[model samples]
Target: MNPGLPFLPQNEPSGHEDEGEPTQTPNLEVKLAGEPALTVAEYVSLRTEILKLIELQAQLLSLALLSLGALLGVAVQQRNSNIAFVYPVLALILSFSWLNHAHAIHRCARYLVEAVEPASGGALGWERFVRQHPLPFGMLGYWGVRSVFMGSSLVATLVGWSLPHPTLLTVIAGVASSLLTLAAFVLFLVWRESSPKQLKVEGHPGSTA
Candidate 1:
C-alpha cells in the first residue's frame, strides 16, 4: 500500500493458508467533500469512459469528412445545386456533436484531477501529469476539425449562391448554415476559455498510512 494514499485501506493477512482459502482485499475508498465515497474500481471505470469518448471524437470527425466528400462529389456530378445545401446542415450537426463530446472529455478529466486525484492523496496522478506536460500542437486536432466543418459549410453556401436563378429556399439555407457555423465557433471558443487550471493538492497533517 502507498503511504501517500491514506484513503486506501491497509490490507491484513487473513492467515487462511492452512485452510486453503484465498484472502480478499478491501476496495480503496475515495471520499470527496459533500460527495459519497468512490472506490478505486469506480475511478478506473471513469477513466475507461474518457478513453471511449476520445475514440468517439475521432470517429465523428471522420464521419463528417467522409459525408462532406460524398455529398460534394454527388452534387458536382449531377450539377444539382440543391444537394450542395445539405452539406452545411450535415456539417453543423456533426461538428456540434463533436464539440459536445470534447466538452464531456474535458469535464471528466477535470473532475478526476481536481476532485478525485486530490482525494486520493495524489496517488492517482496521471491527470496531473498530463496537465503539467501537454504535447506540442495538442490543440491542432480541435482546430483542424473546426476548420474542416466551417470551411465545408462556407463552400456549400457559396455553391448554393452561385446557382443561376437560385430560389428563396436556397438563400435561406445558405444564411442558416453561415449562422450555425458562427454560433458553433463561438461556443467552442467559450468552452476553451473556460477550461479550469490544475490546482495544488495539499497533504493531510500527520497523515501516514
Candidate 2:
C-alpha cells in the first residue's frame, strides 16, 4: 500500500507470494482530470437561481394570459376594437421579458452541466441527464404557449378590422403586432433548438458562477 493513501491496508509478503509481485492501489487522482474549476458552493448558488427563474417564467406566462383575457373582455364589452391594439404591444413586451428569463435559465443550466457536474464526479448530473432524456411534449408545451400569444394577436388584428372606419394606424399596428409575435415565436424556437455543445463553447455572459 502507498503511504499517501492512508486508508489502504499495507501488504505483507507471505511464503507462497512471488518475490517479483507488486502491490497495487487504485489511481483515484485520474478521476480528477478534466474536472471543471467551479467550487461546490458556486454550483449550489447557480442551481438555486435557476429554480427561481423557472418559477418566474411560469408566473410571467400566467400574467400574459390573464392580461390578454381581460383586454379582450373590455374590447368586446365596449364594442370598440381599438382597445385590442394594446394587447400586441403588451404581449410583445411580456414575450421579450419571458425570453430573457428563458435565455438566462438555459445559460445557467448549460454551465451546470458542462462545468459543475464534471468537477463533482458525476454527483451533480441532473442537468446532463435532462439533456439526454428530455420530457415528452416539452416542445409541444412551448409551442402551445407561443401559439396562444400569436393567436390572440391575430384575433386583435381581426377585431381592429371589424370597426366601421378603421384608421391606417390601427391596421398597421395590428399587422406589425402579428408579424412581431410570429418572429418572436420563431426566435424562441431557434434558441431552444440550438445544440448544447455550441452554448457551452460560447460560454455564459455576465455569469458570476
Residue pairs in collision within model 2: none
lDDT on C-alpha atoms for all candidate structures: 0.67, 0.68
The list of candidate 2 runs beyond 4 A from truth reads 1-38, 163-169, 189-209
Model 1: worst 10 consecutive residues (lDDT sum): 195-204
lDDT assessment of candidate 1: 0.67
Worst 10 residues of 2 by lDDT: 193-202
Clashing pairs in 1: none
lDDT of candidate 1 at residue 20, scale 0 to 100: 71
